[model samples]
Target: MITLDLTLPDTRYPIHIGHGLLDQVELILPHLRIPQVAIITNDVVAPLYLQRLTQQLEKHGVRTIPVVLPDGEEHKNWQTLNLIFDALLAANAERKTTLIALGGGVIGDMTGFAAACYQRGAPFIQIPTTLLAQVDSSVGGKTAINHPLGKNMIGAFYQPQLVVADMDLLATLPERELSAGIAEIIKYGLLGDIDFLGWLEANMDKLRARDPVALQYAVRRSCEMKAEIVGQDEKEQGVRALLNLGHTFGHAIEAGLGYGKWLHGEAVGAGMVLAAAASQAMGWLTADDVARVQALIAAAGLPIRSPDFGAAEWLRHMGHDKKVESGVIRFVLLQQLGQAVIQPGLPATLLESLFHSPHIDPALARQ
Candidate 1:
């Protein structure tokens, strides 16, 4: 088992990564604040791994309440969030009751948000099943649901008690979902680690083939990078914004496509390409660097080009982005490969040209 600690100013938690770690009760029991444990999952995930997790918790004499919601990003909203609250209320769960997020990014985000708001905050554990959740969403305490206007527009910075990432769970992931996870993994490399980017380039094939060692290292390195960044700036007051390298454009794509149509990771992959293109336009990145970024994303079987949403539509969706400050949208732009910076009030001409560019698929272009 490999363990990495995420130490923040107000809290700290350990992320445990290994095969079959879910069945190891001792690793989880220590983090429970109470005897009642609530497992929040989705329909897709409950049948796959929930029973085993419940059985493991039961072995430790803990009561389990399983709350399974519909599986999909479409359901990640206030309505679904209310289901968790309703379940907790019906179970007579107290603030001491520990909530366990037992699925992918949607489950982890909603469950963490539920924990944050339930009884003014209850502690929760993350048992991220999907590769996307295990490497990215599950580690950082940034929890939220999609607002009609934008993605993750509603949420909080609530930390988990512990993060249990069992690499074995990834074996069940759909091919598209696995590729989506690679998008976030690539974000870490793009944002600040050139060496890691090179490594990803060298091992892209192994990752796609589901090589065990590659999977473990990707998760570990992503977690380590997040831990270090979160420790430095817990609330995104500063350097943490760098972690959102492709997210602003990515979120816009999600909101534009109407959440669930394009998976978060797919949108991110394309968004990173867009961001790289934007960086090249601003003279920070060369054509070769942009090509490298696009090549890596495409090699991972992820989309590198966005749907052709018109400049007006793109502007409208981006207007709702969380990074907007004083009515100006702030973009995370590449200073170069492996380094990023926040660029606010990006020139309108550049933005419009990017939105109307031929890089976008013509079929998706506005009428």
Candidate 2:
């Protein structure tokens, strides 16, 4: 088992990445303020992991409350979030009651938000079951539910007590979901780690084949990069925003497609491609660089082309992005592969031209 520490200015927590972590109750025992926990998951993940986790905790004499929510990005809203509150209130959960997120990003976000809001604040733990969650969402402490206006517009920077990223859990992850997770891993490489990026390029096939060694290295490296950035700027005051590499455009795609239509990672895949193309247009990257970005995304089994939302509609959806400041949308663009920059006040004509740019146009990209 490999452990990485996220040492923030205020607090520090351990992110445990390895096989069979769920079976290790001692790891979770130390983090719980009380002997009680509320395991928040979804219908899909519950059948697979909820019972096993519950059994492991219960054997240690910890009281466990299972709160199963509906799965999907579309359900990440007020109504769904309220379900957690209902379970907590009914169970007489208190500030000491640790909320354990046992599913993927959705479950983790909602549970963390619940813990933050419950009795003003409560401790929480993240046992992220998906690749995307383990490598990115589970480590960062950025918790949110999707708003119709924009993805993750309503959320908080609430950190967890501990994060358990059990590689064994990923064995059941669907191929599409696995590919989605790789998108974020690729993001870490693209944003700051050129060596890791090259490694991914060489080992893409091994990663796709789910080689245990490759998976562990990818997860560890991705977590290390995120932990470093997040430690420096926990609230996204500066460098942390670079982590959003493709998120501004990706969030627009999620909102434009009405949520859940395209998996977050898939949207990010195409979004990164668009960002790369934009960089080329700005003279930061060459045409070959953009092609390389697109090729990597395609190799990951993600979409390289975005759905055509038209210029006006695209702008409308992106206008609500959390990165927008003073009505100017800040973009996390690349100055070069492995170096990201946050820039605002892009020219209206430049955006108009990008809308018609081959990278943004699905039909044109295919041709």
Candidate 3:
């Protein structure tokens, strides 16, 4: 078990990471001071663990309601968010009602968004089920649905009361999701900590084997690193954007491909590879560094190659990226592992080569 503190300017919250954390939820939840509770999940995740969570809440005498949305990233939008409001209204859930995000990133984002908008903002708890959620989306209070125009554009930066990661539940996750989560784990190592990256390389096999001890350590370290950065820059005025190291490029791939065709982490995994290559091309990193990053990503079951989109279409996708300011596309580049820098003056020739390169093959990425 590992406890990490996320200290923001207004308040601080503890993010608990370990196996069998669901059992400890009731003792932990009441501290949020929520009068009512709503568990937001998806069709896929609800059946697997919802009953256990709901039972725990009921045993604690909490009024619990369940709202299960359709499974898939494509469903993460306003229509789905409306369903949550409908449930809250029907249950007469007030501002004190806490929303529990009971699934992966989608559930966490949607439920948190609903909590933010409920009566002009309520409290939320993150119970991230997937490895992707456990490490990335659960800790940050970035709640949003994908806009037709952009991803996470219409979201609020609302903080959650608590983040509970029940690592045991991840055992039932599909292999692809497990693989996807590794992408974010690797991102942490790539962007900030060379030591953690080295640790991941050493324990990659153990992680795939679902070794409880190894996963617990990985989750704990990742959260601690993120908490430190988020504490320093809660609203993304500076260092926080570094966390989106691969996301700027990844979001473009997701939006272009239409979300759900590729997993979020998978796209980011490939994006990191592309970004690394771009940095190398721009003389920010060595070719050997880019190769090393690729080798590690490929070992983790992530997509190391970009898709084979033409220059125009790729630009069409990347042009809509939210990180772009004044129509200039910006990217977070890895100068090396454990260090990331964002560059806004990326050359158009790089984009042209990126699209034209035969190396960009989605199939090649999908081990």
Give the best candidate by lDDT. 1
Q: lDDT of candidate 1 vs native? A: 0.92
lDDT of 2 by residue, 1-367 (tens): 9999999999999999999999998999988888999999999999998899999999999999999999988988989999999999999988899999998888888888888889988999999999999999989789888888889888889999999999999999999999999999999989998889899999999998999999999999999999999999999999999988988888888888788888899889989998887788788989888888888999999998887788898899889988889999999888999898888957788788888876666553222
Model 3 per-residue lDDT tens digits across residues 1-367: 6788899989889898887888886546666566468989999999999999888878778888899999888989999999999998999988888888999999999999999999998888999999999998898778889987677878889999899998998989998899899899999999999999999989999988889899888888888888998999989878888898888778878877878889999999988988888887788789788888888888888878777666677777777776788998778888777899888857788877766564488453343
Global Cα lDDT for candidate 3: 0.85
lDDT for residue 116 in candidate 1, whole number 0-100? 99
Question: Which residue runs does candidate 2 get wrong by more than 4 Å?
Answer: 361-367
Cα deviation of 316 in candidate 1 (Å)?
1.2
Summarize candidate 1's per-residue lDDT along 124-164 as a digit string, tens digits: 99999998899899987999999998899899999999999
1 or 3, greater by TM-score = 1
Instruction: State the TM-score for model 3.
Output: 0.96
CA-lDDT, candidates in order: 0.92, 0.90, 0.85
| Candidates 1 and 2 compared by TM-score, better number | 1
Per-residue lDDT of 55 in model 1: 92
